[model samples]
Target chain A: MSSPLYELGEPVLRATGLSKLYARRSSDTRARLGEVAGRVLFGRPPKEIQSLRKHEFWALKDISCELHQGEALGIIGLNGSGKTTFLRILAGQILPDGGEVWINGSSAAMIDLQAGFQASASGQENIFLRAAALGFTRAQTEHRLNEIIEFSELGDAIAAPMSSYSSGMKMRLAFSVMAIVEPDVLFIDEVLAVGDFRFRQKCLARIREMRERSAFVFVSHGMGDIALFCDRVIVLHKGKIHFEGPPKEAIEIYESLDEPASAVDTPAQLTKAMGPTFTNSGALKDVAHFWCDESGAPVTNIAFSDNVHLSLEFTSTVDIKRLILGVPVWNLNAHYTTGLSTQLASEELSVRTGERLKFLLEIRGGIANPGTLKSMMTILDGAEFLYRNPNPDLVIENAGHPTWGVVTIPHQWNLIERQ
Target chain B: MTEKLLNTRKERAKGVRIYRPDSRIRQNGLQAVISISREIRNFRSHITTLFTSDFRKGYRGTVLGIFWNFVLPMVPISVYIMLVSLRIMPRYEGLSPAVYISFNVTIWFLLTGLIRQPIQVVKSKNTEMMKTAIPLSAAIVSSFAQLCFDTFVRIALVVVIILAMQAATKWTALFIVPIILSASIFCLGLGLLLSILNVIYRDIERVITILLQYGIFLSGVIFPLASLGPLVSLSAANPFNVFISSAREAAFAGSISQPGALAAWTVVGVILFLYSAWFFYLMEYRIRGSSE
Candidate 1:
C-alpha cells in the first residue's frame, strides 16, 4: 500500500477552483417560446432567445481537494450537490471551466456504472474495450482477462452480449474491468449501494484490495461508510464545500445539520398544535383529501431524494396568529441538516376553528448518501419546540399522526470475487 | 486534516515545451512523447476492438450482421440503376443503360458514406472519448478506422462491378484519394463545428440528418452530373461532389488527373482542415466543459 503511494508522489490528484455548471430545466424556456410563437402567428409579441432564459446552476463551485495516494476522500452532499460531477472532472470525462484538475498519475473515474462498456458486445468483449479505453493494451488485458471475468461473477453471461444482462450485472462487469487497470486514482460514486447486500460486501472487499495501490475518491450519503473507510470527508451545501475534516467530524457536522424532527409519528396530534396556515382542508383552503375507505399506504420509506406531502387536519376555534408550518428530517440517530418552513411573509395566518394545513416537500439527490431516515412535523406558537404527538386539543390543538416519508434512496449493489 | 495535501503546481515551461497542467511532471521531450505515443499505441489494440465492435453494432440485434454493411445499400442502388438505365437513359444520354447507371450510383454510395457518417463523429462518441486524456485526434481516427473498413468492403464491390464493365480504369483514376480527402476534410471541418454546437442543441443532429438526405440527391446519385450541366459541374466542384466524381472517374472511365481541380481542392481541403483543427484547439477547454 505504501509503495503505491510513494510512486504517485505527495498527492495523486489535486483540484483547484473547480466548478461545474448544468443548464437548468428547459421547460420554462419552452413555455415562453410557445407564447412567443403563438403571438407570432396571431400578431406580434416581444421575442427573445429561448435558450437565454434556460436556467444554469453550478453543481460544484470553487471545489478544491487534494487526494493523496492510497487515501480515501469521502464526499457527502445533498442531492444534486455535484459529488459525481467532481469525480467525472477528475477522471477527465469532463473539464472544469474555472480551474484545473492536475493529476500526477493515471486516473479512472466511475461516474456512470455503465460509461465505458460496449453495450451490444458480450461481457468478455466489453471487458477488453473498457480496459483499452482506460489505457491498457492487449497484452496486459489478455493476461488479466481471466482475473477480470472471474471477479465479475458473470458466469456464462460473459459470452453473451451485454444487452442481455441485467443492469446490476453490467455495472459489475464495468467496475471490475476498470479496477483491473490499477489506475493511480480511482473514483467510486455511490456504486456500493447498487446491488444486494451480499454482493455489496464482496465488491467492498475488492475495493479494499484495490486501495492497497490506488487513492480513491468516494461519494455516498451513508455516513457509516464514510466513518468506516474514509481518511477524510468533505461535506457540501448547494455546491460549496461547507465542511472538511476527519470522517467522524465531517459526518457529525453533516448529520447535525441534516436531521430534523419527524412530522408523522404524531400526525393526529398536529391538528391541535395549530401553528399557522391552517384552513378547513389545507392552508388557503386549497388541499383535498379522499380518505375514509380509500387509504393508500403512505409511502413511508423516506430518504433524501423524495418529495414529501405533509397533511394535517385541525379545528381552529379562535383566529390563529403567526403560525409556522414545517417538516424536519431527523436521522436514525437524530441529527439535523436544516429546518424548512412554510412561512410566506405575504400570506397572513387568519384561520378560525376547524381547518387543515397541507404542503409538499421536494427532495433532491446528493443530500444524504443512503440509509434509514426519519422526519417530524412541528406546529409551534411564538418561539417553541413542538414535536406533534397525536393528542387531541382544541383551538391551537388536536391529535397528530405521522403522515408519510415515502421517498427512498436506492441502495444499488455490485459484487466481485477474488481471482 | 493536514496542510500538506493542498499545495499548488507551478508554471515552468517556456514556449513549445510539453505542458503538464500539474507542473511537477517535468516538461521534457521524452516524457511527452512516451506518454502521447502510448496513447497512440493504445489505439492499435483498439482498432480490432473498434472495427469488430463497429462491424457488430452496425447490424446488431438484426439478422445478417456484417453482411448488411456490405449489401444493404446495394439493393436500392441496383434497383435505381435498373429503373434509370432501362427507362430514363434513352431520353438523356446515348450510353448503355445498365453500364451508365451502375457506374454512376456506385460512386454516389461511396461519397454518401463519407458525408453521412463523419458528421460530428466526435460528439456522438463524446461520452466515451472524453472519459480519458487520450489525444482528441484519437477519437476522429477511430471513427475513420470504422469508415475505412466499410469503405474497403464497398471498394471490393466497385472493382467487381467495374471489371464486369470491361472498362479498364487507368492509373489516372487515383483521384479517389483527393476526393476522399475533400469529403473527409470538409466533413471534419463541419464535424468539429457541429460537435461544439451539439453540446448546446442536440437538434443539430436532426438538422444534419436532413442535410445529408438533400445532399445525397443534390450530388448526382440517381442521375449523372452531365444532366445538371455547367451549374452541376460548378456544384460538382463542391468538395463532396469532387469526392464522388473522383471515385467515379477512377472506377468508371479512369481519366482523373484533373490537376487544376485537384490543386484547387487541395487548397480548400487544407484550409478547412487547419481552420477546423485550430478552432477545435482554441475551444478545447470550453467544449470539454460544455459536454457535461
Candidate 2:
C-alpha cells in the first residue's frame, strides 16, 4: 500500500473526489429554452434541467490521488477513459463539476506542445511569446533565452518564421522551453512520442533529471515508457480507478482488459467441464485442456535459456483426416513471434469420429524478451483451421534480458585496436 | 491524529509543501470583479507582448507599412469631400464641410474599429486562447491597443486637415482627450460583450456586420444630423452621434452643448464594462467547452 518514493516526500499536489459530467447535446427546443431560462434566472445551471434532456455521463468520477515531490505517477488507460480530462482538470484548464484539486507551487503543463506559438513569428519570437503565455516576464525569459536556443539546437533556423519549421523542430523548441522553466510541478501528456528516437531519449533523460527536483504526472499508453519512468501507477477505466499499484501489476491489469471472457466461446461451460486450467473453443475440434512442463515437472514460470514443454488435449466430434496441430507464440502486445507445426515436422496423423488427441510441443524461452508470452493451440486439417484454443491464456513468464523486441538472437561483439 | 501525522510528515520532508484544493463555486459580482482584476494584473506582461507583436505583424507585409493606418481612414474623408464639392450632398451651413465631415468620420472609425477588433481577434485566435492559460482579457486589451494606435493616426490627420483649411483654433480643443476616452470606454464595454457572445453564437458576427454597414449613414458621419429631416431626433439620440458631435464642437465651435448626456453615457459605459467582464468569467468554462 505504501511506496518507497511516496514516503520520501510530502504530497505536493492532491485531488479529492474530483468529478466532471457533460450533458448530451440537446435536440428538443423546449429543453434548450429551459436551460437558458435557468441560466438567466439563477445564474447557475439547474440540476433538474439535465433530466429534461436525453442524459448526461460523467467524464471523471470521484477520482482521488496524491503526487509527492521527487515522484512520478503514471496514468494508464484506454482512449476515452478520462485520462486527458483528469490532466486538464489538474492543470487548471478546466473546472471540475464536483470535488476539488490543490497544488503547492507554480506549475506548467505541456498538454498541447504548440498551444501558444504564433505561426507568423520567428522561433526566437515564439519562445518569448510562449514564455509570456506561461506567465514568465520579459526579463526572466531574456535571462534564459540563450540556454533555450542552445537546448533546442535550432541554430540559424531559430531566426526564421515558425510556419517554415518542421513539426519535429517545433516540438523540440516547445519541449526545450518548457523543460528549462523548471516549474515545481509538471504535467506531460504523450508528448514524448513525437520527434526522432534520439530526441525522445534526450527528452526522457531531461524529464528524469527534472523529477529529482520536481513532481511529474505523466500520461502515456506505452507500457515500456511507463515501466521505465513511473515510481507508481494508476489504471483508469470507465471514469474510475480500476487499479492502483506497482508498474508491473498495473500493466498486467491493463493488458487483461483487452482479453474479454467473451473472446473465448462459452468460457464458463468450458472451465466447468475441463477444470479452470483449460479453455474450450467449442468449434469443430475443441481444445478441452492444456498445461506446461519444465524438465518433465508441471510448471508455470521458467528461467532464461531453459526449455519449456507444452501439452494440449483436443477432441473432434466429426472425423478429421490428416490433422495438423500447431502452437503460435505471442508477446505481451499479442504480436506473433514464433510458431511450431506438426505438418512442418512431417508428423501429421489421421483421426476417426469422436477421437481425442494429445500433442506435446517444446519451446525455447531464451529467445523471448523478459515479459509475458502467450501461446495458442490450433488444430488444422491442411490449410483449413478445424479448431483453435478460444482463450490464448497459456502464459509463460520469461526471465530474460530487458531487450526492445519480442525475440533476441545470439550474437558476439569484439573490440578492434586502431593505429 | 491524522492531521498531526500529516504535519509531522511534512515537517520531516525538508522543502516539500502540502497542497489542498480550494472550493470553486458560484461567486457574487464583487467577487468576480476582484478575481478578474487580479487575473489581468497577473498577466499584464502577456497582454503587452500580445499587443506589440500584433501591431508589428499587422503592417509587416505592406509597402506603405504604418502609413496605411493613416491612409485607411482618409478614403472615406476624400469620398465625402468630393460628394459635397460636386453638389451631390448638402453641406452644413455654419460648420465647414471638410472639418465637420473629417472630425465625425475619424471618431466614427475609432468607435467602429474598437468594437469590431475584439470580435475579430477572439475568432481568429480561438485555438491559442483555448489551449493556453492566457487570460481572455489579454486578447481584448491587445486588440484595443492596436485600434487605439490607428485612432491616434486618424486624429493627427484631422488636425492637419483643419490647419490646411484655415479653421480658427480654439482654446477648448484640449477637451477632445476626455471626449475620446469616454467614447473608447463605451466601445470597449460593447466590444467585450460582443466578443464573448460571438464565441457562443456565430450569427452575432454577421448580424453586427450588417448593422455597421447601415450604422455609418445614420450616425451623421457623411453629413449633419440636422439635415436628416424626419429622422433628426433618432439621429441626434444615437450614442455615436453624441460622441461625434461633441468631438466636432470641441474642435471647431470650441465648446460642448450637452455635457450632461455625455457624462451619463460615460457612466453607463463604465457600468456596462464591469458587468460584461463578470459575465465573461462566469461563462469561461462553457465558452471553452462549446468552442472545442
Candidate 3:
C-alpha cells in the first residue's frame, strides 16, 4: 500500500492563497437603482451599498495544497464549506479573486457529469460534442467512439436523441466520454455517486487505475470512500482548511465535526462522565443520572447473552399526566434497532411539577450487535410531546458475536441425511 | 495529528509553493494579454465544438430546419415590400423596394442576432460552462461563430433577392465585403461587452431587447433614409444606418457612399473590439463569481 509519505515526489499541482469573496446581492430593485443613482450623482456609493460590502465573506481563504503524481487527495466538508469552490478554482473553471494555481499538466474535471450535453442531439452526436467541449479533437473522439459506446452500453439508443434517454443513461454516456480522456491531472466532485452500484464500482475501479497514472483531487462527503481511496485527506470548515492528514485521522476529525442531534450534550458529558455514554440529554425532562443495574453502578460495557437492567432518573418542570416512557436504540449507522415503550406494556406513570421519576428498563444483550448502540429517551403524554431526548445518557455496549447490522438473532443450522 | 502531518510534509516536499492572501503576484497588462491569448489558444477546439453544437441545435427541432434561417428574416422583408408596392410607404429612387428592404433587413438581422445572442449565451449556459473546464471566452467565440453562420444564410437570401429584381451588378459591389466585415467586428465587440454586463446586471439584457426593437425602425431597414425629413441628419449619423445603407448602396446602386464614415466606423469597430476584450479579461473573475 502506498502511504502518503511513501508517495512523495515533485508536486504536479500547487495552489496558494486561493480566496473568493462573495458580496451579498440586494434583491430590491429600488435599493440597486438608488445606489447607482447615488454613485452617478455624488461620485460615491450610498450607505446601503457600503453595508452590502460588509456582508461579503470569503468562500475560500488561504487554501493551499500540493498533489504529487500517483497520489489521490480527498477534500471533505459540509455544504457551503468551499470544497466545490476550491475544486473549481483548481480546475481553472473559475478564477480566484486572490492567489494563483499552478498546474504542470493538462487537467480534466468531472464536476458535473451532465454538463455540455445537448438534449436535441442524438446520443452519438452528444458524445462527440461533449468530447470536443473537453478539448478533444474530432479525430481523437472518432478513434474512441466505439469504446465510449460499448462502455455506456446504450447500444441502439446511441442513435436516439439525448432527451429520450433516462438520467442514468445520460450520466453513463457522460462518464464514458470523460473516462476516455486521459488528462495528467483529474478533479472529481461527487460524481462517484452516479449510476447503479455496479456502475459506481466500475467507475471507482477506473478512477483507481487513473490515479495510478495521474494526480487526483477528489471531493466527497462519504468518509468510507475517502478512507479507501485517499492517501491524504483535507477537512474544510467554513472556507478554511480545518485539518489535513492521513485519511483515518482526517475522517475522525470530520465525523466529530458533524452537528450532533439537538438533545445530545456531548461537551457536558465529556467533562462529567467517568466512562463512555453513547447518548445524552432529555429535551423535556432533564436526565440526572443513569445506571445499568440495581447496583446503581454505571454499565460501560456488557457481554453477549447477558441480561442487563437500564435505569434513568429525570425531573420534569411541568406536570405530565398519562405519561409514556420510550427508549429507542440505534446502531452505529444510525439505523433504528428496536423501541421499548411503557405504553406497550400498558403501564401508566404520572409526574407532577418538580417531581423526579425513575424508570427501569431491561434488555437481552445478545439481541444487539457488537458495536456502539445509542439510546434515545422520549416521554409523551397522550400523544402530546412532553419531553424527548434524541441522545440520552444511557448507552448499551453489547459485546456479542462479530456481526453487521442493528440487531442479532439466534438460529441453528441442521443437516439431514437423505438417501 | 494535522500539525504533525503538515510538518512532515513540509519538510519532505520540495518546490511546493504555499500561497497566502497577501502573497499574490499581480500581472501587468502585457502579461495579462499574453496569458489570455494563450488560454484562448489552448481551448480552440472547445470553442469550435460549442459553436457547431449551438448552430446545429438552434434549428434542430424545426420542420424547416436550416431553411428557417433564410425564411424568418424574409417575413418582415415581405411585409415591407407589400407596403411599398401598395404605395403605403415611399419607394427608394432607382431601387426595387423588395430588393432594398431585403438587403437592409438581412444585414440588420445579422447585426441584431450577433448583438442579442451573446447576452444570453453565457447566462443561459452558466451552470454547464462553469462546471466544465472550458473558458468563458470559448462560449463568447461560439456565439460569434453561430452569428457568422446566420449571417451567411441571410446573405444568401439577399443575393437571391438581388437576382430576382434583375438589378444591375457593378464591380463596386465588392465593397460590401469590407462593410460586412467591419460591421461584424463592431457587433462582436459590443456583444462581448454586453454579455459580461448582462451577467452583472441582468437588466441590461431586457434593455438591449427594447433598444433593438426601436433600433429596427431607426436603422433605415424597412424605410428609405430620405424619408426621415428633418431627422435625416440624426438617422444618417446612426452607426446602424451607416452599416445598412453602405451595404445597400454597394449591393443595389452598385456604388459606395459616405466612404469617410465607413472608414471611421471601421476604426471604431477595432477600438471597441480591443477595449471590450481587455475589459472582459480584467473583470472575468468578478463577472463569473457574481453569477454564482
Candidate 4:
C-alpha cells in the first residue's frame, strides 16, 4: 500500500543519535543523594549539565531514524531491547540523555490505551475526561462523541459506569477514542492486538486508512502484523540497531538472531542428563535428539521445503506397557508453532529393561516458519506425564523463508473467467 | 512536558515541536512568570474540567453531595463552640467567647486545609501526569481552586455567625481581606513545595500528617499562646499565628497587635510563592521520574 504521498520525501519525524542512560540499582541511592544535594544548593542539578556519569549504562545508544509522510516504520526487537524506551523518547514522555527529536506537525502516542479513564464515571462522561487529558477542548471532544460511540459499538452501554464494563469493553472504548482523534504523527507500541479477532481486523483497517494522512512509528513482535502495516522495518538488538531494510529481510535477520539461552518455556530446575538411562516408568533420559534427511544421516540444518525426520534415542531400565511421546516446537517468541504426538499417529510399542529404543518421527511436510525452534520431549502414560525434558534438546534450524506466518500449506492460485 | 508551553515563534508557525537534552523552560524570573501565565491561559479549560471533576468525585455517592464540603467543616467548629459554651475555654481576643472561638477555629480550618490538601491532590494525579501532556501547573491550579472553593464555603458560615452573635464591628475589619489573601498565598507556597518533596520521599507525607494532628494546639488557634507567657514570642513568630491573630485583631478590635510582623510575613509569602513556583518548574523532570 505505497501511496504517492509516501514518495514526497517530506520528513515529518526525525531522530538523530538518541541515547538514554540509567544508573545501576546498586549505585542509584548514592547518585540520588548527590542529585538532591546539588538541587538544594544550586538551582538545577549538575547531572543535567554533564549527562554522562559513572555506574550508568546506556539503554539506547546512537539510534537515528527519519519517518516521512504516509510511511509506517516498524521496530522489532526482543524484550528489554530498548524499543519501548526509544518510543517513549520520541513521544516526548521522557527527554533523551543525548541527541534531539523534531516533529514537523502535531503528534499523538498510543503507548497506553487505557491511560486515563475514571472508573466511577459513566462512559459518556469519561469521554470528556479522556479528551481533556489528551489536551483537547470540550467543544472539540463533543464534535466526535457520536462517532466514537458508534465505532466502539457500545450503544446503550455507553450510559453505564466505566467500572461496570468488562475489560474488553473498556479496551474497545479506549481504542475507538484514540482512533477517532487523528494527528499528523502517531506513535503506537504493540496496542494493535485488542479485543477479539473481528475487532482486531476492524482496528487494522482503521489504521490502514489513517496511514494515508499520518506518519507512524510501529513497534510489535508479531511479524505478520509488521509485514501487513509497515513499509520498512528496523531490527534492534541489545540497545543497538542490528539491521534496517525491507520488512521481509528484516524479519529474516530478526529470526536468524540466536535465541537467548534463558528464554521463556524452560523449566525452573533442569535435571542434568548424563545420557539415556530410562527406567521406563520412573524416567526417560534423552541420549541424543537430532534431525536427519531422507537418507537418515544426521543434519544440523533443515530446509522448510525438504523431507526430514526427528530421531530420539533412550535406554530403558524396566519393561514399559504403554508409552506416549509428545514433541512440541516453540518459536523464538515463545509461540507454540506446531506439535507431534505418537498417540495421534496410533503407534503402540513396548520397551523391555536394558533395551535401547530408537523412535523415528517422520515429517510428512517440513516444519514452517524458518527460525531456530526449540522442542521438548514428554513421555506420558495415558493422562499422566511420566517424564519431561527440563531442557529443550532438539533445535531445528530453518533459515530465510519468504513466507510470513507459522504454518505453510501448498495451494494453487488460478483466475477463472466466471465474470 | 513543560517544553510544550514554550509556545514561542515555533509554536505559532504550525506547531513544530522540538525536544532535546536539558530543554529548560525558564532562564530568569520573568520567563518563569511568563511561562506559568501562558500555561494557565492555554489549559484553562482543562483546569476547569479537572476542578469540577475533583469536587464531584470527592462526594460522588453521598446523598448530600457538595453540601458535605459545607457540613464537614462545621463538625469541628461545633465542637469548639460547645467547649466555649460549656465554660471550659476562656474568652480570646477580648470578644464574646463563642464568637472568638468560632472565628479562630474557622480560620484554623482554612489554614490547615490549604496547606494539607495539596499533597493528596497532586499525588493522586500522578497517573494523570504520566499519561498526558496536561501541564503540571494546570493540576496545581485546579487543586488550588478546589481548596479555595471549600474555604469560601466555611468563611460564609463564619460570617453568618458573626452577624447572629451581634459582635462589635470595626472599620479595620477590611484588613481581614489582605490577611486572608496573605495566608492563602503563604500556605499555597508551602503546600506546593511539600507536594513535590512528598513524591520523592513519601516520608514527608507521613511526618506532615503526624505534625498536623497536633498543629492546631501549638498554632495559637484554640488556646491563647500569649497568655501561656513563655510561648508568646514563638507564637508571634509562627506565620500561622500571625495570619489568624491579625485577622482576629482587625475584625473585632480596630487595631492590630503586631502589624509589622503581618506586613513582613506577607512579603515573605510572596517571595516564598515565587521561589517555590520556580523550583517546581525546574524540578519537573525529576518529580516525574520519581513518581513512578
lDDT winner: 4
Per-residue lDDT of B196 in model 2: 66
lDDT of 3 by residue, A199-228 (tens): 889888888778778788999987667877
Q: Please write out the lDDT profile of model 2 over residues A167-218, one tens digit for every residue.
A: 9999999988887767788888898876788888888898878877888888
Interface RMSD, per-candidate values to 1 decimal: 11.1, 5.8, 7.1, 3.3
Going through the candidates in order, their DockQ values are: 0.21, 0.26, 0.30, 0.42
Clashing residue pairs in candidate 4 are: none
Fnat per candidate, as a fraction, reads 0.22, 0.29, 0.33, 0.47
Q: Which candidate is the best by TM-score?
A: 4
Q: Each model's C-alpha lDDT? A: 0.59, 0.72, 0.71, 0.74
Worst 10 residues of 2 chain B by lDDT: B16-25
The 10 consecutive residues of candidate 3 chain B with the worst lDDT sum are B16-25
In angstroms, how far off is B106's CA in candidate 2? 2.7
Which scores higher on lDDT, 1 or 3? 3
Please list the residue runs of candidate 1 whose C-alpha ends up more than 4 Å from where it truly belongs after superposition: A1-9, A26-54, A259-419, B1-41, B58-66, B88-107, B120-124, B128-143, B201-208, B229-237, B250-258, B281-285, B288-292
Q: Which consecutive 10 residues in model 4 chain B have the weakest lDDT in total?
A: B283-292
Which residue ranges in model 4 land beyond 4 Å of their true spot? A1-5, A23-37, A48-57, A258-263, A266-278, A281-289, A293-303, A312-361, A364-366, A371-392, A397-406, A411-418, B1-14
TM-scores of chain B, in order: 0.69, 0.80, 0.79, 0.87
lDDT at position A80, candidate 4: 76
Compute each candidate's TM-score over C-alphas: 0.67, 0.77, 0.77, 0.85
The docking category that best describes candidate 1 is: incorrect
